[model samples]
Target: STEALSLLEASGYDYTNIELGKEWFLLGGEESVTRVALSKEVESGATSLPKIFVGGQCIGGCSELASLIDNGELDALMKKAGATKKGEPKKNTGFLSFLNL
Candidate 1:
């Protein structure tokens, strides 16, 4: 879970972290309600720990997150969610940069 959090932080996207306690396992509690809600949203139908959701959509676990980062899709998703990079904007060095693409 820590690895997942680290990856997300490194992505430079604004995010909120919610940690659930043992009480979350107890039925009928607020945490449990949240868990249930997450389960419904999760595609696997199992609420796994360290699940990452972007724009109210599940993006899977740490492995999935790492994959997105490797393939450069995370930036697109973050932009779609209205999150800009934390620091200076990325410079475009490709040929399309001349067109401000």
Candidate 2:
């Protein structure tokens, strides 16, 4: 998970690390942002975990994510998401706002 986040970060995208299962509740009181649960069960036939939802759309799992990144789709998506240059306030959302997840 750290590696994944680091890769995204190195690529100039904003991300948050939510360690689920450590807490008793699923949402862990952070309800507004999207929650992506990564689990082996979802990787199986369950079709639920590792679900990527950008602007409320269900993008697929690891392979799909990799494809997007490799093909420069992820960078374009992040730019559309209003991710600004480092140290600059991201349009309307602040730095902390991006990390609030």
Candidate 3:
């Protein structure tokens, strides 16, 4: 679980680790809204274990995350979350900038 979380972190995603049967309730709380949202993603078909949510959308598990990272799609989503890789902001340099306004 730690390794999986590391991959997400390495990919510039902000995530929380929840130990099932131990932190279940704690993760379900309002303070851990992202954790709860991730859990729902797992419950639904949107994502498997080690779930991820970007802007309230399920981004899927570790393997899926890896794929997105490999394909550069994960970086796009991270930017959408107002997050940066290694604390460096991502600049919109492509046609997407036309919609930035």
Candidate 1 per-residue C-alpha lDDT over 1-101 given as tens digits, one digit per residue, 9 for 90 to 100: 87887887787655667677665556543447766876787788766667777766777778888999999898887766665555645432110100000
Give, for candidate 3, the lowest lDDT window spanning 10 residues: 92-101
Q: 1-101, model 3: which lDDT tens digit per residue?
A: 55557676576444445444434445545555544555565546332345555555555666776788789787677677665444454543221110000
Question: What is the TM-score (0 to 1) of candidate 3?
Answer: 0.53
Better of 1 and 2 by lDDT: 1
Q: Write down the lDDT that model 2 would get.
A: 0.47
Candidate 2 per-residue lDDT over residues 22-95, each given as its tens digit: 23235533351333333332334233334444443445544566788889788677666665656666463422
My TM-score estimates for the predictions, one after another, are 0.72, 0.50, 0.53
Which is better, 2 or 3, measured by TM-score? 3
Error (Å) of candidate 1 at residue 40 is 1.1
Question: How many collisions per candidate?
Answer: 0, 0, 0
Question: Residue 70 in model 3: shift from native, Å?
Answer: 0.7
